[model samples]
Target: MAKTVVITGGVSGMGLSASKLFLSKGWNVMIADFNKELGEKVYKELSSKYSKKQVAFQQTDVSNATSVTDLKTKTSQLFGKVDSVINNAGIFTKGALHEVAEDAWDRIMAIDVKSVYLMTKAFVPDMIEQKAGTIVNTASISGLTGDYNMAAYNAAKGALVNLVRAMALDYGKYGIRVNNINPGPTMTPMFKANPQSVIDTFKKASPLGKLAEPDDIARVMYFLASDESNPITGENIPVSAGFEIYSGQPVQK
Candidate 1:
């Protein structure tokens, strides 16, 4: 029998890549994302290529507890049980601390931090009951270090990093494993959404000549989700391609 996995924000970017990888690995993937149309399209694309039993999608807004609950219920109905979850739904905010709007900060926190809490709350019980599961959260390098004009995103991701550790400790005895991946300058939609000047500055700051692709992040997520990492838990693994170790330095002109 195929393992069942639920992925939040699986419609695009890193989540989408992870969904594809899991499907390739013979897991039944239940994708949850806010964009109903895109989610449906991706589901169709995957289902057309694979068996319908291997992939599905549920429209979800992870920031809403009700929606997350519905996602959990629907996923269980679609696929008997969920063996793993990827809490990858997140939003980014960039601005000077004083200039950042309160609503923007709240939105970022709600999606990046609160969503993890909600999803874990909704789905972890099943894992605990079954005495086996894995959780992979998408944090950011900003959470480990810091960067200018990313106060809210940094703070929320940092909170998520610690949350993963606490959950790992709390659930380890139940055979549940929790971990986080901190990606740096990934070439996702969020990265491209930044101002060109901001993007240029970030490009110059990284030791690597290019930003990471979504696959780079997704591959690490795959490892953490699989039994291959059965012994690993509570780890804040960095997928930054040496960017995490670089000191601030201007790119050579």
Candidate 2:
């Protein structure tokens, strides 16, 4: 039987790209997202390409335990055992520490960090029963280093990076793996909303001199989910195109 995977935020951006990649690899996929319209649309689109039996969509609010549980239940019904769960649903916010709005802080933490906990709670038990599974998170370079005006996002992703580490330790004994893919500035809808100057700066900072496409991150997500990375867990693999390698010094011509 083909392996089954659940991908949150699987309607758009990197999540959508990853869903397609997994389908192409002949995996049974359940795409979970908060947007019902987009979810149904993507479900139809993918169903046209692959068999309906191999693809499904569940409208989910990942931060909410009840919704997450429903997602797990439906996915299980559709695909049987989930071989992997990709926590790719996330929201981004920008502001200095004190300038950050209380609601923004709470919302970002709830979506980016708490959702992972809820997901693990909902799925890991079944994984443990099966004695095999993988969990992949969509983290960011900001989690590893500070950003000028992104305090809340940094803190949330930072928590996620460490969460992956802690969960790996807790779950690895059961033959489950936990890891995150930390991508630099990617040209997702969120990045495209930034000022052009800000986008240009990110381009210049990367040695590759360009932003990552959604597919770029999706490929790494696939690697982490596959048996190819069985020995790797509790790790944050950077798909940043060398954006983090700079020392912040101006190069002398």
Query: Which candidate number would show the highest lDDT if scored against the true structure?
Result: 2
Worst 10 residues of 2 by lDDT: 241-250
Candidate lDDT values, in order: 0.90, 0.93
Error of 2 at 6 (Å): 0.6
Error of 1 at 70 (Å): 0.8
lDDT of candidate model 1 versus the reference: 0.90
TM-score of each: 0.93, 0.96
Q: Tell me the tens digit of each residue's lDDT in model 2 across 1-253.
A: 8999999999999999999999999999999999999999999999999999999999999999999999988988887899999999999888999999999999999999999999999999999999999999999998988889999999999999898999999999999999999998888887799999999997887888898999999999999999999799999998897877777888899
Look at candidate 2 and give me any clashing residue pairs. none
Please report the TM-score between candidate 2 and the true structure. 0.96
* Residue-level error in angstroms, candidate 2, position 143: 0.1
How many residue pairs collide in each prediction?
0, 0
Candidate 2 residue-wise lDDT at 189 = 82
For candidate 2, the per-residue lDDT at 23 reads 99
